[model samples]
Target: MSTVFDFAANLLGGGEKPLADFSGQVLLIVNTASKCGFTPQYEGLEALYRQYGARGFSVLGFPCNQFGAQEPGDSAAIAQFCSLTYDVTFPMFAKVDVNGADAHPLFKFLKGEAKGILGTEPIKWNFTKFLVDRKGEVAGRFAPTTTPKDLEKEIEKLL
Candidate 1:
């Protein structure tokens, strides 16, 4: 019975933000990295957000350094990079571990809800995305190779 709303994580700005704040909206939750090759996907994510934000859809970004130390920056750095580089305006959270023993509870729950290729659960790389429906149920999982723009159809279906 635990939806994403049952979890809370620190905002990139410095406070705990309940996932409940995003309840009733279809969500595309992504584990991001700054220096990774897939970093440019931020533009596509922002595009999706801008295009569908008014329709009860949102893209929540979480910076993660767990992969190749690609995101080795502090909250301020991450926030600035996102704003200045990609003009991202979506809600972003503090850095979090998306895999291993210390993975964030919300991510652990998401992984369980949407297993990856061949039923694998671990996130393979940065830019991993999980799409959630309005009811907070995880609808799909996308690998780093799956660009954000490529998910528009599925996102539309969820909306």
Candidate 2:
């Protein structure tokens, strides 16, 4: 009976943030990478956050270096890159592994709630997104190729 609200994550700003703090909000949880080809997706994600954030919508970014060592930066560098390059304003968590034994507990719960293509649980690459509804239930899983802009309608429905 574990919900997303049951977990907590370390923020890039250097503290633990319980998911329960975002209760009743539609969340787009994304595993991001600063050097990935899809890095630009941050801009679209920021747009989505700005467009719907006031309506109980949020984009929670988690940087992961498991793929091609694309996100090797520390919290400061990640924060700076996201700020200066993409101007991302949404909440971002400390770097974590999206796939593997050491995967963050929240991610484990998210992947368990929403499997990917062919019922796969592992995140295929960086930028893979998991959408959670207001009730902290996983709504859908989007692949790395799926752009943040592509999830607007679905997010609207949840909101």
Cα lDDT, all candidates: 0.96, 0.94
- All candidates: CA RMSD in angstroms? 0.6, 0.6
| Clash-forming residue pairs, model 1 | none
Off by over 4 Å in 2: none
TM, every model: 0.98, 0.98
- Tens digit of per-residue lDDT, candidate 1, span 32-135: 99999999999999999999999999999999999999999999999999999999999999999999999999999999999999999999999999999998
Candidate 2, run of 10 with poorest lDDT: 143-152
lDDT of 2 by residue, 5-65 (tens): 8999999999999999999999999999999999999999999999999999999999999
Best-fitting candidate, scored by lDDT? 1
* Candidate 2 CA-lDDT value: 0.94
